[model samples]
Target: MTTWLITAEETVIADGAAPHRQIEIIRKVHGNKTREEALVELHKAAKSHVPDSLKGTSRVVGRDSDGSCWILPKNGKGHPPCVIRFVEQIHP
Candidate 1:
Protein backbone atom coordinates (compact mmCIF):
# COMPACT_ATOMS: atom_id res chain seq x y z
CA MET A 1 0.00 0.00 0.00
CA THR A 2 1.14 3.51 -0.75
CA THR A 3 1.26 6.16 1.88
CA TRP A 4 0.00 9.46 0.58
CA LEU A 5 -0.48 12.81 2.21
CA ILE A 6 -3.26 14.86 0.73
CA THR A 7 -3.04 18.45 1.79
CA ALA A 8 -5.79 21.01 1.59
CA GLU A 9 -4.37 24.47 1.76
CA GLU A 10 -6.53 27.56 2.05
CA THR A 11 -5.43 31.00 0.94
CA VAL A 12 -6.89 34.43 0.33
CA ILE A 13 -6.17 35.85 -3.06
CA ALA A 14 -5.93 39.43 -4.30
CA ASP A 15 -8.98 39.19 -6.56
CA GLY A 16 -11.48 39.93 -3.79
CA ALA A 17 -13.01 36.56 -4.49
CA ALA A 18 -13.87 34.15 -1.73
CA PRO A 19 -11.04 32.34 -0.04
CA HIS A 20 -9.89 29.28 -1.97
CA ARG A 21 -8.50 25.90 -1.07
CA GLN A 22 -6.41 23.45 -3.05
CA ILE A 23 -5.73 19.75 -2.59
CA GLU A 24 -2.70 17.83 -3.72
CA ILE A 25 -0.72 14.69 -3.18
CA ILE A 26 1.83 16.57 -1.17
CA ARG A 27 3.72 13.44 -0.22
CA LYS A 28 3.31 10.07 -1.79
CA VAL A 29 5.52 7.09 -1.24
CA HIS A 30 5.69 3.30 -1.06
CA GLY A 31 3.40 2.60 -3.97
CA ASN A 32 3.99 0.59 -7.10
CA LYS A 33 1.38 2.56 -9.04
CA THR A 34 2.33 5.23 -11.51
CA ARG A 35 2.08 8.87 -10.50
CA GLU A 36 -1.07 9.20 -12.57
CA GLU A 37 -2.77 6.36 -10.75
CA ALA A 38 -1.95 7.82 -7.40
CA LEU A 39 -3.30 11.19 -8.41
CA VAL A 40 -6.53 9.70 -9.72
CA GLU A 41 -7.23 8.02 -6.40
CA LEU A 42 -6.33 11.13 -4.51
CA HIS A 43 -8.68 13.27 -6.58
CA LYS A 44 -11.58 10.90 -6.01
CA ALA A 45 -11.12 11.11 -2.30
CA ALA A 46 -10.93 14.89 -2.49
CA LYS A 47 -14.18 15.17 -4.40
CA SER A 48 -16.32 13.99 -1.50
CA HIS A 49 -14.08 14.21 1.50
CA VAL A 50 -13.71 17.84 2.41
CA PRO A 51 -14.24 18.69 6.02
CA ASP A 52 -17.63 20.20 6.87
CA SER A 53 -16.26 23.59 7.79
CA LEU A 54 -14.28 23.94 4.56
CA LYS A 55 -16.94 22.46 2.30
CA GLY A 56 -18.53 25.79 1.51
CA THR A 57 -15.63 27.19 -0.48
CA SER A 58 -12.87 24.61 -1.00
CA ARG A 59 -13.17 23.10 -4.47
CA VAL A 60 -9.85 21.45 -5.10
CA VAL A 61 -10.06 19.02 -7.98
CA GLY A 62 -7.06 18.68 -10.24
CA ARG A 63 -3.32 18.49 -9.71
CA ASP A 64 -0.44 17.96 -12.06
CA SER A 65 2.72 16.04 -11.24
CA ASP A 66 4.38 19.43 -11.14
CA GLY A 67 1.88 20.36 -8.36
CA SER A 68 -0.29 23.03 -10.00
CA CYS A 69 -3.89 23.01 -8.75
CA TRP A 70 -7.38 24.20 -9.66
CA ILE A 71 -10.69 24.82 -7.89
CA LEU A 72 -14.32 25.02 -8.99
CA PRO A 73 -17.81 25.21 -7.57
CA LYS A 74 -19.47 21.99 -6.54
CA ASN A 75 -21.05 20.23 -9.53
CA GLY A 76 -19.56 22.76 -11.96
CA LYS A 77 -16.78 22.32 -14.51
CA GLY A 78 -14.13 24.06 -16.61
CA HIS A 79 -12.32 27.33 -15.94
CA PRO A 80 -11.25 27.28 -12.33
CA PRO A 81 -12.09 30.19 -10.05
CA CYS A 82 -8.42 30.47 -9.29
CA VAL A 83 -5.17 28.54 -9.27
CA ILE A 84 -3.21 27.38 -6.28
CA ARG A 85 0.29 26.90 -7.52
CA PHE A 86 2.93 24.85 -5.87
CA VAL A 87 5.47 26.79 -3.87
CA GLU A 88 7.83 23.86 -3.48
CA GLN A 89 7.97 20.10 -3.12
CA ILE A 90 9.66 18.72 -0.07
CA HIS A 91 11.04 15.20 -0.48
CA PRO A 92 12.18 14.68 3.03
Candidate 2:
Protein backbone atom coordinates (compact mmCIF):
# COMPACT_ATOMS: atom_id res chain seq x y z
CA MET A 1 0.00 0.00 0.00
CA THR A 2 1.07 3.60 -0.56
CA THR A 3 1.74 5.74 2.48
CA TRP A 4 0.43 9.32 2.83
CA LEU A 5 0.73 12.03 5.45
CA ILE A 6 -2.21 14.38 6.08
CA THR A 7 -2.32 17.63 8.04
CA ALA A 8 -5.20 19.92 9.08
CA GLU A 9 -5.53 23.58 9.93
CA GLU A 10 -8.28 25.77 11.38
CA THR A 11 -8.33 29.34 10.17
CA VAL A 12 -10.30 32.53 10.66
CA ILE A 13 -12.33 34.02 7.86
CA ALA A 14 -12.26 37.63 8.93
CA ASP A 15 -8.52 38.24 8.84
CA GLY A 16 -7.08 35.20 7.08
CA ALA A 17 -4.92 34.50 10.08
CA ALA A 18 -2.93 31.46 11.14
CA PRO A 19 -4.69 28.18 11.72
CA HIS A 20 -5.79 27.38 15.28
CA ARG A 21 -4.79 23.70 15.49
CA GLN A 22 -2.97 21.54 12.99
CA ILE A 23 -3.48 17.79 12.94
CA GLU A 24 -1.56 15.13 11.06
CA ILE A 25 -2.43 11.66 9.78
CA ILE A 26 -0.53 8.91 8.05
CA ARG A 27 -2.57 6.59 5.85
CA LYS A 28 -1.91 3.80 3.36
CA VAL A 29 -3.69 3.31 0.05
CA HIS A 30 -3.57 0.66 -2.69
CA GLY A 31 0.05 1.04 -3.81
CA ASN A 32 2.97 3.32 -4.56
CA LYS A 33 2.10 6.63 -6.14
CA THR A 34 3.25 10.12 -7.03
CA ARG A 35 2.24 13.18 -5.04
CA GLU A 36 0.04 14.65 -7.77
CA GLU A 37 -1.87 11.41 -8.28
CA ALA A 38 -2.37 11.02 -4.57
CA LEU A 39 -3.70 14.56 -4.29
CA VAL A 40 -6.27 13.93 -7.02
CA GLU A 41 -7.58 10.90 -5.22
CA LEU A 42 -7.60 12.76 -1.95
CA HIS A 43 -9.62 15.59 -3.48
CA LYS A 44 -12.11 13.09 -4.84
CA ALA A 45 -12.42 11.31 -1.53
CA ALA A 46 -12.73 14.52 0.44
CA LYS A 47 -15.32 15.98 -1.89
CA SER A 48 -17.98 13.62 -0.65
CA HIS A 49 -17.26 14.23 3.02
CA VAL A 50 -17.03 18.00 2.76
CA PRO A 51 -20.11 20.05 3.52
CA ASP A 52 -22.08 21.38 0.59
CA SER A 53 -21.43 24.97 1.63
CA LEU A 54 -17.68 24.39 1.86
CA LYS A 55 -17.30 22.06 -1.11
CA GLY A 56 -16.35 24.75 -3.60
CA THR A 57 -13.79 26.18 -1.23
CA SER A 58 -11.69 23.08 -0.57
CA ARG A 59 -8.12 23.11 -1.85
CA VAL A 60 -4.83 21.24 -1.57
CA VAL A 61 -2.44 23.08 0.67
CA GLY A 62 1.25 22.17 0.33
CA ARG A 63 3.69 19.40 -0.54
CA ASP A 64 6.19 17.90 1.84
CA SER A 65 9.87 17.35 1.02
CA ASP A 66 9.09 13.66 0.49
CA GLY A 67 6.54 14.70 -2.18
CA SER A 68 3.44 13.99 -0.13
CA CYS A 69 0.67 16.51 -0.73
CA TRP A 70 -0.97 18.32 2.18
CA ILE A 71 -4.70 18.53 1.56
CA LEU A 72 -6.57 21.29 3.34
CA PRO A 73 -10.10 22.67 3.37
CA LYS A 74 -10.46 26.35 2.64
CA ASN A 75 -12.95 29.20 3.21
CA GLY A 76 -14.53 27.64 6.34
CA LYS A 77 -14.03 25.59 9.48
CA GLY A 78 -14.45 22.08 10.99
CA HIS A 79 -13.06 19.85 8.27
CA PRO A 80 -12.72 16.12 8.83
CA PRO A 81 -9.93 13.72 8.01
CA CYS A 82 -7.93 16.89 8.16
CA VAL A 83 -4.72 15.46 6.77
CA ILE A 84 -3.44 13.58 3.75
CA ARG A 85 -4.77 10.56 1.84
CA PHE A 86 -2.82 8.23 -0.46
CA VAL A 87 -3.63 6.97 -3.93
CA GLU A 88 -1.98 4.98 -6.73
CA GLN A 89 0.05 6.77 -9.37
CA ILE A 90 -1.71 6.97 -12.69
CA HIS A 91 0.73 9.11 -14.69
CA PRO A 92 3.99 10.99 -14.57
Candidate 3:
Protein backbone atom coordinates (compact mmCIF):
# COMPACT_ATOMS: atom_id res chain seq x y z
CA MET A 1 0.00 0.00 0.00
CA THR A 2 1.60 3.22 -1.13
CA THR A 3 1.06 6.57 0.59
CA TRP A 4 2.23 10.18 0.57
CA LEU A 5 2.83 13.01 2.96
CA ILE A 6 0.62 15.90 1.83
CA THR A 7 2.62 18.78 3.12
CA ALA A 8 3.54 22.30 2.20
CA GLU A 9 4.83 22.35 -1.39
CA GLU A 10 7.79 24.41 -0.27
CA THR A 11 8.93 21.68 2.08
CA VAL A 12 10.93 19.98 -0.64
CA ILE A 13 12.84 23.06 -1.74
CA ALA A 14 13.45 24.24 1.81
CA ASP A 15 14.85 20.95 2.98
CA GLY A 16 16.27 18.44 0.52
CA ALA A 17 13.21 16.32 1.11
CA ALA A 18 12.75 12.60 0.88
CA PRO A 19 9.02 12.48 0.02
CA HIS A 20 7.95 15.14 -2.44
CA ARG A 21 6.79 14.67 -6.00
CA GLN A 22 9.50 14.44 -8.64
CA ILE A 23 9.41 16.40 -11.90
CA GLU A 24 9.57 13.22 -13.95
CA ILE A 25 6.02 12.25 -12.93
CA ILE A 26 4.65 15.48 -14.39
CA ARG A 27 6.54 15.30 -17.71
CA LYS A 28 6.14 11.56 -18.01
CA VAL A 29 2.50 10.79 -17.47
CA HIS A 30 1.12 7.64 -15.92
CA GLY A 31 1.60 4.45 -17.98
CA ASN A 32 4.43 6.15 -19.86
CA LYS A 33 1.79 8.19 -21.62
CA THR A 34 2.94 10.28 -24.52
CA ARG A 35 1.77 13.89 -24.48
CA GLU A 36 -1.08 13.14 -26.88
CA GLU A 37 -2.11 9.95 -25.08
CA ALA A 38 -1.95 11.67 -21.74
CA LEU A 39 -4.11 14.50 -23.01
CA VAL A 40 -6.75 12.11 -24.29
CA GLU A 41 -6.74 10.05 -21.13
CA LEU A 42 -7.03 13.08 -18.92
CA HIS A 43 -9.81 14.58 -21.00
CA LYS A 44 -11.86 11.41 -20.71
CA ALA A 45 -11.33 10.83 -17.01
CA ALA A 46 -10.41 13.85 -14.98
CA LYS A 47 -13.17 15.94 -13.40
CA SER A 48 -10.87 18.85 -12.74
CA HIS A 49 -8.00 20.20 -14.81
CA VAL A 50 -5.19 18.02 -13.52
CA PRO A 51 -1.62 19.20 -13.30
CA ASP A 52 0.34 18.37 -16.41
CA SER A 53 1.68 21.89 -16.21
CA LEU A 54 5.27 20.74 -15.63
CA LYS A 55 5.21 22.78 -12.43
CA GLY A 56 7.17 21.28 -9.56
CA THR A 57 4.37 19.83 -7.43
CA SER A 58 2.85 16.62 -6.17
CA ARG A 59 0.51 14.46 -8.19
CA VAL A 60 -2.27 12.40 -6.67
CA VAL A 61 -3.78 9.42 -8.42
CA GLY A 62 -6.85 7.36 -7.71
CA ARG A 63 -7.85 3.84 -8.70
CA ASP A 64 -10.96 1.73 -8.76
CA SER A 65 -11.97 -0.08 -5.58
CA ASP A 66 -10.31 -3.19 -7.00
CA GLY A 67 -7.03 -1.36 -7.48
CA SER A 68 -7.32 -1.18 -11.22
CA CYS A 69 -5.54 1.81 -12.71
CA TRP A 70 -7.45 3.46 -15.52
CA ILE A 71 -8.67 6.78 -16.82
CA LEU A 72 -12.00 5.44 -18.08
CA PRO A 73 -15.53 6.80 -18.03
CA LYS A 74 -17.77 6.63 -15.02
CA ASN A 75 -19.63 3.39 -14.24
CA GLY A 76 -23.04 5.07 -14.31
CA LYS A 77 -25.21 7.68 -12.60
CA GLY A 78 -26.50 5.64 -9.63
CA HIS A 79 -23.59 3.56 -8.35
CA PRO A 80 -23.66 1.48 -5.18
CA PRO A 81 -20.51 3.00 -3.65
CA CYS A 82 -22.73 5.97 -3.01
CA VAL A 83 -23.59 4.67 0.46
CA ILE A 84 -20.15 5.41 1.80
CA ARG A 85 -18.12 8.21 0.34
CA PHE A 86 -14.46 9.02 0.69
CA VAL A 87 -11.55 10.14 -1.42
CA GLU A 88 -8.17 8.44 -1.25
CA GLN A 89 -5.12 9.25 -3.28
CA ILE A 90 -2.90 6.59 -4.86
CA HIS A 91 0.67 7.65 -4.24
CA PRO A 92 3.26 6.80 -6.86
Top of the candidates by lDDT = 1
TM-score per prediction, in order, is 0.39, 0.35, 0.20
Order of the predicted models by lDDT, top scorer first: 1, 2, 3
Expressed as tens digits, the lDDT of each residue in 1-92 for candidate 3 is 32211211111222465644322111223344344454444333333323333133333334445322222224332211111112223665
TM-score, candidate 2, is 0.35
> RMSD (Cα, Å) of candidate 2?
8.8
lDDT of each: 0.50, 0.47, 0.30
Can you write out model 2's per-residue Cα lDDT over 1-92, one digit (the tens) per residue? 45554333333233467445443333334456666776766655444344322456755455556644444656445553244444343344
Task: Provide the clashing-pair count of each candidate structure.
Answer: 0, 3, 0
For model 3, the stretches where C-alpha displacement exceeds 4 angstroms are 1-29, 47-92
Model 3, C-alpha of 16: deviation from truth (Å): 38
Best-performing candidate as measured by TM-score:
1
**Candidate 2 deviant stretches above 4 angstroms:** 11-19, 24-27, 51-92
Candidate 1 collision pairs? none
